[model samples]
Target: MGVDDQSTLQPMDDTAWTFLDGRIDAVLTTVRAESADRAAQGQALTALITSLG
Candidate 1:
């Protein structure tokens, strides 16, 4: 779940993938938080895409 605006130079490693789970968890948490706070789906989705980026 890691990338830069520049070219993909340094390849991703296995260790980096391990942290991907936590990143996904955080994105879900943010989505839930937005819903709990009555935020619009658009806002939640924005957060989701931002996390993936």
Candidate 2:
């Protein structure tokens, strides 16, 4: 979707908004899950490093 003006707000279709909202939600969920997994792995690595040292 392209915007006509930066300052002016244009009316958008309800269905378009709904579709965009769903897509954004899916992206957010995926990002959150990946971040959680990365954090857990980092904690485990830190624990292992401390034990080795």
lDDT of 1 at 24: 59
lDDT (Cα, tens digit) per residue for candidate 1, span 1-53? 33652234234554554455456565577666734644554565565566568
TM-score of candidate 2 against the unseen true structure:
0.42
* TM-scores for the candidates: 0.34, 0.42
lDDT of 2 by residue, 1-53 (tens): 34744223224556645554555554455556745666555555554455435
Best lDDT goes to which candidate?
1
Error of 1 at 10 (Å): 20
Enumerate clash totals for all models, in the order shown. 0, 0
